[model samples]
Target chain A: MIEQVADPLPQTGFAKVVLELEVNNHPGVMSHICNLFARRAFNMEGILCMPVAGGERSRIWLLVFEDQRLEQMIRQLEKLEDVLAVRRHGAEHEVFERLEDFFH
Target chain B: MMQMTGAQLIVRLLERQGVRTIAGIPGGAILPLYDALGGSELIHHVLARHEQGAGFMAQGMARASGQPAVCFASSGPGATNLVTAIADAFLDSIPMVAITGQVPLSMIGTDAFQEVDIYGITVPITKHNFLVRSVEELLTVIPDAFRIAMSGRPGPVLVDVPKDVQNQLISFTDFPPRVVSDSLPPVDAEAIEEAARLINEAEQPVLYLGGGVVHSGASALAVTLAEQACMPTTMTLMGLGAMPVDHPLSIGMLGMHGARYTNFVLEEADVLVCVGARFDDRAVGKAAQFCPRAKIVHIDVDPSELHKIKRAHVAIHADVGSALEALLPRIRKSMRKRWLSHVDSLRSRFPMQLPGMDDPRTHYGLVRAVAAALDDDAIITTDVGQHQMWVAQAYPFRRPRQWMTSGGLGTMGFGVPTAMGAALAEPDRTVVCFSGDGSLMMNVQEFATLAEENLNVKIVLMNNSSLGLVYQQQNLFYGKRVFASKYGAGPDFIKIAEGFGIGAVDLDQAANPRAALAQALQTPGPCLIHASIDREQFVYPMVPPGAANTEMIGG
Candidate 1:
C-alpha cells in the first residue's frame, strides 16, 4: 500500500498504476486484461472490481509498470475507452493504497 | 546548355532533401550512380549484401525515423530483388525512394544484357513511379519523388534511372518548387463534428486504435479521449504500439487472435469509436458479426476507409489526434462504475495462459519467460508458425503499433527481413523475432543483410524439425496426412546461420535459458536463439473457419 504522499516524484522505479473499468463486465474482459499484463509484463497484484452499487455497468482495475516511455502506457489505458479515470493509484505513483491479493 | 549526368543531378536533389544515406547494390547499369557517389560528401551509400535487403533497410529507416529513406538497385536481378520489400513498404505505408538502374536509353525494349522491366514490375507496389529518359528532367523529378513518398498516406516511391541518364550530368541546380504542399484534400470538418457528437452522447463506449494512430502521432490524444469518456479500447495488429501493455482501459487486441474479452466488449458497446483503424478482416474476423451491436464511429485521414468494410454510424475524415482534441471537451464525463466492472470481469475470465514450461530449455518455457521478461516496451517480429500464434494469443498487447505483422498478406519469410527495418528505425530499442523452421528458410539470405547493416535483431527460431504450422493445420483439418510440411530432411538452421557469421545457441543444450537469451540480446550484431518446439502443438482460441468470433477453440 503506497500511502498518498505529497507530490512525490511520480513514484519512479518502474511505476505501477491501476484503472478499474466496467465496459463488458464479463469473465472474458478480466482474462484479456490479465493476459495483456502478462504479455506486456505488468505485474498486477490484484484486480478488486465487480458489479457496482447500481449494477448498470462493470468496473475493472489493472496494475502496470511504466517509465518515461509512459505516454504509450497511458495510451493503453485510454484505448479501453471504457476506463473512467485510469487513476494512477499504486506503488511509486501519485496515489498509493494497500491492495489485498484479490487480483491474483 | 551543358552536358550533365542524371546521377549528379540526383545527388544534388537528395542533398537538398536531407537524404544522408542510400541502401544499394552496385551493378552494371547503376555504375554511374555509384560513380556519382565517389566524391559526394552528403550521402552515404550502404553496399547491401542483397538488393532486397537494401529496400527493406531503407523501408526500416524510413519507418523509424519518419523521414523518406532511399534504396538503389541495378538492372535485372538487382531490380527484381528489391520487389518484395517495395511491395511490403507500399502496403505498410512506409516512406521510401527506390532508385533502380536500367539499360542504356538506346536499348529500349531490346532485352539487352542485364535489362529488365524494373519500372513496370514496381508500378503496382509503389505510390508513384517514373522511368527517367532525360537528364534535364532529373533536376525537378528527383526531389518531387522524395516529396510524394513522404507526404499523404506515406508509401514507397520508385524512380528508374537509365544507365545513360546517369552518365549525362548537366549543370546541377537546386529545384525548390518540386515539393507540393496542397496536393491532397483538406480534412473534412462536417464528418469530424458528426463523429464527435456521436461520441459525446454515447453510453456504452469503446475505442478501436489502429496504425493510423501511430502514423498521425496521436497516441496521447487516443489516451485522453478514452480516459475522459471512460471508454474501453482495442488495437489492430498494425496499431499495437499506440499504447503500452498493461493499461487498465486496454482490453488486449481485436482480431482473429485478439482477446476474447475485446470482441465481447466491442460486441456490447453502444458506440464504438474507431480511430484510425480500418476494419480489416484480420482485425475484425467475420465483418458481419464484428461489433454487431455497437454503433460504429469510424475516423481516418483516408476518406475511402469510412465505408470500406463496416459502415460507420458516424464517419469522420481527420487525423486521430487532432480529432480527439476537437472532440474531448464536447463529451460529457460520467461515472460508469458498472461499465468498468463488466470489462474487468471479461479481462479476468479469459486470461491468455499458455502451457506451463517445466524446463528452462524447452521452447514453450523459453518463449513464455522471454515474453514475460521483455514485457511491453519490447517490439517482437515473428516468422509465421505455432510460435507466432503462441506469441499473439498468449502475449499482452495494450499499446498501439506494438505488434507489426503482415496481417492482411501473411507473407512467409517476413520476420527477419521486417525486423531489419524495425531495428534500423529504432536503433536504441531491442527488436526480437520468432522464426519457424519453414518461415526462416524462405528468407535465410537476410542474415547477411542483418549482419552487414549491423541491425540489432534477436531471433528465436522454434525449430520443431518440421513445417510446424502447416503440420498443425493438416493434423487438425486433414487427419494428420502429412504432405510437404516436413523440414526434417533440410540443412541444419544453426549451421546455416553459422555459415552467415551470426551467433547461434540451441535451446536444448543451453543450461540457463534466460541467461542464454540475455546474452544473445546483449550481442550487438544479429544472433539466433534457436528453440526447438513441439511440432504437434496447435494454435488455440481459433474460431474454426467461418465460425462465429465467439466460437474460438483451444486455450
Candidate 2:
C-alpha cells in the first residue's frame, strides 16, 4: 500500500505562461530554442512537442514562468529559421495540467 | 548522374557550398569520409591536434568570412571533444556544419566499442543533429544543414553518419537546387509606426545594439538610423565594434564591466531601442528594476527575444537590416541636446582610469600598448578571463567582426584556435589572440596547429600566474581563502611556445615589452608574447552578482 505523504510542491508559485510554436521540422530547431533559455538560466516547467500535418512542420508548447522576458522570448522564437508562428496562453491553458493528471 | 559512395557525396555537397576548408581529425569510424577527402582538392582539410581545436578553427573561419565552416570527427571521444566547440558556435551564433562518424547501424544502442549516441548527445547543443539511417539522407541532409546554419539566426548544425552509411554506394547526381524560403512575414506596419511614434515623442532615446547587427550585416543601417535620429547608442558585449568607438553617438559597451557612462545612459533613457540583443542578465542587471522608466523597443530577427527580459512597448519582428532600412525614412529627425550633454558629462566625470597606465607592465597598460601597435582593422580574438575584460575595456574596435570572444559561454582557451580559424579564413587580415595564463593552458596544445599552419596569428598571453578572475571572485565573495586559484609560479610560456615551434617572448624579462610585442605582431607566422602581470590584480568596476547595472565595487 502507498503511504500517505505530502508530496513536494514548487515554492515559487509563479504563474506559468505557455507558448505555442509552429516550426519547420528539423534537427537543431528545438536545440536553438532551448539553448536560448538555458543560456539565460531560464527554466521551462513543461514541454510538449509533436509533429503536425505530414510531419513537414511541428508544434511545440513550452510551459514557463510568466516573467518579464516572456514577450521578448516569443519574439526571439519567431525569428528562428524554422519557426513559423507563436501564440501565448495563460496558466488556464490546461496543456501541462492535463499532462500532469495523465501522469499522476 | 554518376554513381559514388556516400562519402563522395559528403565531399561534393561541401564543394557545392563553397567550403574551402574542413578542420578535423581522422579516426576509426570516420576513415571512409577521409578516403573521400583524399580524392578532393577543392575542399581543403585542416588537421587539428584535437577535435575541439578543429571545431574552434572552423568557428574562426566562419566568424571571419560570414560563411558556414565545416569540422569533422569520429564517434565517442572525438565527437565528445567537438561538443565544446559546437556549443561555443551555438552560443555565439556562428554558422558551422559539424560532421561526425557514428558506429554501424547494427551496433546502435548496444554500447559497442568506440561508439557513442552522438546524435542524441548533441541534440541539446546543436541547432540541429541528424543520425543517418541510410546513405540517401546525405543528399538532402548536407545541403539542408548548410541552408539552416546560414539562414536566420545562423548557428552550428550537426550531421552524424554511421560507418556503413558512409561506405554505402549512392547515385551521385547534379547538386540539388538550393532551397530558398522567402518565408519571413512582412514587417508589421502598425508596429513600425508605433516605434516611430515612441522615438519621435521620447525626449531621451537610446539605440541598444547587439551582435545581431553584425550577423545581419546591418551595422551601417543601424549607425545611419542612430545618426539620423540623433540618438545616443550603446552596445552589448557581443555588439562591440557595431559602431565606431570614436563615433559621437557611440557610447561603448553597457551592462556588467561596461563603461561608467554607458550604463548610466541606459538607465537614464526614456525609450531603449534594442536591436538583435536578448536582454541578457549581464547586460540588464536585475531585469525587474533595469531601466525602470524606459519604454523598450526591441528589434530582432527572432521573435523570442522581445519581452523575454524587459517588456517591450513596440516589438518589430523582422530581419534587423531590413527593419532598420524601413524605419530610417519614418524616424523623425529631432535633437536630444540635453541627453547628449548629460551622456558627455557622465563620460567626462567618470572617465575610464586605466590602473598602472604609467607603467607598461600592467594588463591595461599592455592592452593599450597592443592597441596602439595594431590598427583598428586588425581582428582581436580573446579567451575568457581578466585579460578578456581588459581587452574589451581598452582596445577600441572600430568595426564589426573585428573583435571575437566567447561572450555567452565565456570559454577559456577559445583564443588561439578561433584566431587560427580567422587567420586561415582571411590570410591578409592581422589576427591577434589575447589570452590569460589560465585560459591559454586550456587549449595550449593548439599552439602546434598554429605553428604547423604558420598562420599569421599573434597570441598576447597575459600571464597572471593564477586563475585570475576566479581568484578575484573568491577574494570578494568567499572570504579570500584561495583554493586552486593561484598556479604559484606558472610554467614558462616562452619555453612552451618554443616547444610548439612557435616564436616566443617574455614581456616581464624583456628589456622592452612594447618593442618585443610589436616585433612579434609584425612577424609573418604564429608567435606568442607572454606579458606577466601581478596575480593580485583584479578586473575592477565589478558588478557583484545579481546587482544592478548602476552598482559597482571598484575600478
Candidate 3:
C-alpha cells in the first residue's frame, strides 16, 4: 500500500487571507470541505468551526494564502450543496487573529 | 396516517418517482430492502453479477432515458465494488441514485462484518450523499437524493441506509411529493445579449457543444443556432450526437483525435461559443494554447465552470436550452461564404483518412460495417480504448442520447452493462456495445444478466488480444517499450459467451462477415459478435498528450 505523508510546509512567499463559510451542520460536511482542499493540494494554514443559527448551521473560518487558485477554490467551495454562504476577508479578520496565541 | 418499515417506504417512494426498473444484487445487509422490492409489482429488479455491473447498468438507464436511475448494493465489498460505476456516473453528469445497505447505525464505526463507509467514500464522486440516521430521515433523504441528482448539472447521489433502519417502522401522514429538477438558475440577459452580439459580429465563429447539450435536451436548438448564425459546429466526445455528423455545418468532434480540418477550423476561429461543455483536458489540449485567437462565449448551468478555464468574454450562467432559446432570436442569419469556403478547402486538404473501410476484417471497416447494419435509431455504446475512439470517429450518430460512452471517467468495463441498461429502459430499440478484447473481459460476467433479462443488446467485440490504447501510447511516446499490455494467451470468448447462455459468432471464421454481422445484430436478443482486429492497428490523427490540437502525429 502506498503511504501518505503529511503535506510539506506551504511555500512562504504568498500573502495569507481568511475565508468564512456558513454550512449545514452535519457529520460529513467537514469531510466534503476538507476533501476539496486536499484533492486540489491547496493548503489551509489554520481552521476553526463552530455551530451557529441555534446549532442548525456551522460557521467555519479558514486561513490560507491568497494564491492564483484561490478564486477558483472559492468558486468550488460555493458549489458544495451544504455550503450556504462564503465570505472572504484579508489577514486582518479578528476571528483567526484572536486564536493565534492558541496555535503557538 | 400510514405506517411502514423503512424498506417498504423506500420501495413505495421509488415507485412514486416512476422508477420501473432497478439493477442490483441482494446481500445480507440489503436483504430487508430486497424483500420490500420483491413485493412491489411496479419495479423490476435486474440481478447483476457484480455491484460494479449493477452501477453501470443504472448509469446506462439514466444515460438513455435522461432520468435519474437507481442501483443497490450491500455493505463492505458490495459498496466498495460500486465505487467505479458511481464515479463514472458522477463524471459524466448522469443522474443516478445508488443506495447501499450499511451495518446497523451502532456498528457503523466499529469494524463490523460486511460494513464500509460508503457515504464517506463516495463524497468526492457523488453530487450529494446521505447516511440515514433514523427511519424518519428516509422520508426526506429519498426525495432529496433524487432532487439533488437531477437539479442543475445532473450527477449521481448515494443514500446509505443502515440495515436496522431498513427494518425500523415509521409512521407518517403521507409520503413526500415525488421530486422534479430544481428551477434553473436565472439567466443573465445582458450576458446572453453580449454573447449573441459576439457571434453575430465575428467572421469565423465555432459552436462547441458538450455533454450539457444532451443533458439539457438542447441538441435541436444548438443545430438551429449553428445554421442561423452560419457557424461550423464541433462536438466533444460526450456531445457526439448533438449534431448529425454529416450535416453541412458539422465539423465532427474537436480536440484530441479530432479530424485535422476540425482542429484547424478551431485554430482560425475569431469567436468560440462553448455551450454546456467544460474545457476538459482531453477535449482542449494545453488550455493556454486552445482557441488562442478567439474570444470565448461560455454558457453553462454551473457558475463555477464559467471562468474556470479559458476566461469567457461573455459568460451566461443558465440552462443550455434556455440560453440557446434566448440567443436564437438575437442572432442574425449570415452566408459566411468566405469562411465556409476556407473551411471546405481545409477539409479537402486534411480529411479523416480511413485506410481499410471496405474490408470487414479491419478496425475502421468493422465500425462502418456495424453502422451500415444499424440505423441512426440504434443506441450505440463503447468500452474505453482504441475501439471507442475508432467508433467515435467512424459512427454516424445522428441524434441526442443515441451515443453513450464513458467520456470523463473512461471506465473499461462500462460497455456491456450500460448497453444492457439502455436496452432495459428502451426495450423497443436495439442496443449495441462496441467493446475491445480487454474491456470485454472486465465485465463479461454481465452476459449472464443480459441472457436472463433477454434484452436486445448486441456485443460487438473487437478482439486484438491487447490493451490497444496503452500499446499505442507506449509505441508513440515511450520508445516502444511495451510492458504488460499484451496478453500471452487469450480465452475463447465464443465458448465464454455460450457458457454464459448467450449466443456467440466469430467473424474471423465467417465466409461472409458482413452478412453474419447483419444477421447477428438484427436477430439479437443477446448476441456477441467477435472479430479479430490486427494488434498493430492504431487510432490516428492523434494529438500527443499535452500537445496542441494542431500538432497531430498520424492518421
Among these predictions, the greatest TM-score belongs to 3
Alpha-carbon shift of residue B422 in model 2 (angstroms): 0.1
Which lDDT value does model 3 have at B229? 96
Cα error, residue B76 of model 1, in Å, equals 2.1
DockQ scores of all models, one per candidate: 0.01, 0.19, 0.36
Docking class of 1: incorrect
Error of 2 at A88 (Å): 7.5
Q: Looking at candidate 2, what TM-score does chain B attain?
A: 0.98
What is the Cα-based lDDT of residue B96 in candidate 3?
A: 98
Model 1 CA lDDT for position B261: 73
Question: What are the lDDT scores of the predictions, listed in order?
Answer: 0.72, 0.85, 0.94
Question: What digit string (tens of lDDT, one per residue) describes model 3 on residues B1-555?
Answer: 899999999999999999999999999999999999999999999999999999999999999999999999998999999999999998999999999999999888999998889988999999889999999999999999999999999999999999999999999998899999999867788888899899989999999999999999999999999999999999999999999999999999997899999999999999999999999988888787899899999999988898897888998889999999999999999999999999999999999888899889999999999999999889999999999999999998999999999999999999999999999999999999999999999998999999999999999999999999999988988889999999999999999999999999999999999999999999959999999999999988998887888888897
Relative to the true structure, candidate 1 has a C-alpha RMSD (angstroms) of 20.7
Q: Which segments of candidate 3 are over 4 A away from where they belong?
A: A1-10
Order the candidate numbers by lDDT, best to worst. 3, 2, 1
Best by lDDT: 3
**Taking the tens digit of each residue's C-alpha lDDT, what string does model 2 give over B191-291?**
99999889988888999999999998999999999998899998888899999888999888887788777778888889999999988877877777688
Better of 2 and 3 by DockQ: 3
TM-score, every prediction: 0.78, 0.90, 0.98
